[model samples]
Target: MRAVIFRLMGVIVLMLVGAGLVGWWFGPLPAALVACAVALVVIGVDTAAQLRVLAWLKWPRHDNIPTARGVWAEMLYRAARQLRLWETRVAHEEDKLKRFIEALQASPNGVILMDASDQIDWCNDTAAAHFGLDPKRDLRQHAVHLIRNPEFFAYMGAKRFDEPLLMRRNGSYGPLLLSVQIIPYGEGEKLLLSRDVTQVERTEAMRRDFVANVSHEIKTPLTVIAGFVESLRALEFSIEERDHILGLMQEQSDRMRHLVDDLLTLAHLEGDPHQPAEERMDMRQMVERLAADARALSAGRHRIKASADAGGLRGARTELTSAFSNLVSNAVRYTPPGGEVRITWRVLHPDYGDPYAEFSVSDTGIGIAPEHIPRLTERFYRVDRGRSRESGGTGLGLAIVKHALLRHQSELRISSQPGLGSTFSVRFPLARLDLAKPGQAAGAPDAPRADRESISA
Candidate 1:
């Protein structure tokens, strides 16, 4: 600024001398007036240009007094130019930062910005939704008062910025599992991020239930086997006693084998999210075969009845067969002596919808509680763990059935009341059914001669 003032002053001094010389040479006032006017125009133009440069510099402080041109003047001019460049760079950086913050606000995870005093400064739409907050109204509020979780409040009070807190909170929207983290930013500011973990929490619960079920299933059979082994090792026994022990051991072995097979089937089902669905088989024939298996498994303890209309269903034949067999076997195993297991297959026509084939298995067995019905399809979930284990159940049969139905675009609906009975039905979409193949058996299979039952005690 000083440099610019000096240049203006130099022009004025030179103009005065020149004007005096012109007046003396020309011997008139007009010549001096013209010289003065030209000098004023020159000084005005020079001063305007200097002011433009000064505006570009954006100096923190200014000194407008004129000074002589020297090394100090040149140094100050260079410093002003450097200051302008720095200001430009800072403005550019701020623009970039603004864009970054905008992007963060648009992120799916909830984000909240807090000041050093733990007051909320800014938050994104997701954060507002998670906390059931009004973005405009909730500004500058205390974070602790808004969240209302005891654990979260304690975490904030302790200034625990390193460890994140996981808590379940009930907001206006719904119950949500949140993982909250507080990060320290520049100038005593804090950035809080919250991520929904409801699905993760559910998966962990399923894992724990699965592990516990497997342990219990294995332990029961192991206890029986150990008892028989101890009995044999204790003393020499009569033939009948040894035979009885041997029989018990065989029963335990068979139960273990059945459990292992069911486990393997469940693992295979879970391994393939998208199973083949091109194979089509006769629904009537599938029902008959499953009923026959159920009757064989029941050993005359329960009567297995099957009724079906002729229809072809499209799906993985082996998987459907296995799923149907599991349901039928479960009915037969759970029902008491003289109880009935009825298997029905019929096309259901809704009042204003297409026809769908509904395959149902209803049994007169101990029913399940309403609360436990929803979780019955989960892997290793059982209503009566002891009874299920005693009946050689792996607790994965229903899970397999559920997955199989899902793969075929069908749905499984189970209805039950305590002690009355349980009905398990698989409703296939109408598009999945076709006419039965020519020359195939359309009705129930011919009853075979009585033979040894599949289950042995």
Candidate 2:
């Protein structure tokens, strides 16, 4: 302020000196009038410069201020410099805000920013989806009114965030679960974060059910064994009775063993992914072996026929045999006496031009319901629990088949109708089909009567 005052005084004095020099050539009266006019003109010019600077302040687009004299010029230059600093700060803050919003937009989980009163301030697409909100339309709307979940509102309203809130959205598969957490910040502003936990919850539930089923399965046999052991220990019995008890015990033990083996096989199949076998195995031989096992299991109860033309498969020999045998055994077990179970093996060329080795087992017995067909491959799933137990099935046959086929890059396809019988088919990809060996380049041999055998135990 002092510098401005000094500059103004110097300008006034300079104007006075000019006016005095001009008036010295005339009289005293003219000198006084000329000095007054000079002062007015100087004041008018300074006013005009200040007005221009004022206009620039209102709309400061020019890079530099207009040229002027005295304090008005200094004020204009200083004002433009200060405007530049303000612009820089404003730009920095705006860029930071933009990046923050973009980060929220890209986040996998949902995020919502709410003001002090729980009004929707801003939200990303994920958050919008989480709460079924429209980004633009729902701005400034109350969250509770929009989401309408009492539990969610209670969670946020309580202002106690010791644990996250769990909510189930409507119209989702098995109630699509969401875990939400609220964080309060900046004078009652809140950040609401949410994540989908439906899969995790489903897995946990499946694990619990598996443990329970396994425990029950084991307990039944253990109880039976304990009862028999007690009977043998406490009371004297004839040799026949002892032998009968022993036989029952052996059957139970074998049942348990089969269950454990199936469990182990499943564990091994699910453990790791590896390269498939390069060596080809005679699929015809494998089908014959499966047929033999199925006949033994059927024990003349069912009519069985085995036919195969497919050559070989490029996969773990044991896994392939296990899967094929399981399907054949299941057919035999489910089919009643005199029912026919036919097995066929052929190479199928789909419309996509890819060939698949198809092994299918069709049974003429009580068929599976449509609803039960999809879950037949799930562990422990059964069409009829009592019938499954009576048939000596471990209930893991289909699951093992499914997993084994997965390992071989194949798939299991099931078709069935109630009271019309079922067909369990496997389609192994061409990649896993070993065509012919170098020495046997002529191609695979024809399946004769001996290869396609039909016999009952």
> Best-fitting candidate, measured by lDDT?
2
TM-score, cand. 1 vs. native: 0.77
Worst 10 residues of 1 by lDDT: 448-457
lDDT per model vs. reference:
0.80, 0.83
Cα displacement (angstroms), candidate 1, residue 449, comes to 32
lDDT of 1 at 289: 81
State the lDDT of candidate 1 residue by residue for 131-216, as single tens digits: 77777898899988988878988998898679888988776667999888999998888999999888899899878877887887
TM-score for each of the candidates: 0.77, 0.84
Q: Pick the candidate with the highest TM-score.
A: 2
True lDDT of residue 346, candidate 2: 81
lDDT of 1: 0.80
Prediction 2 TM-score vs. true = 0.84
| Candidate 2 Cα errors over 4 Å, as ranges | 1-20, 27-42, 62-89, 172-174, 273-279, 350-352, 437-457
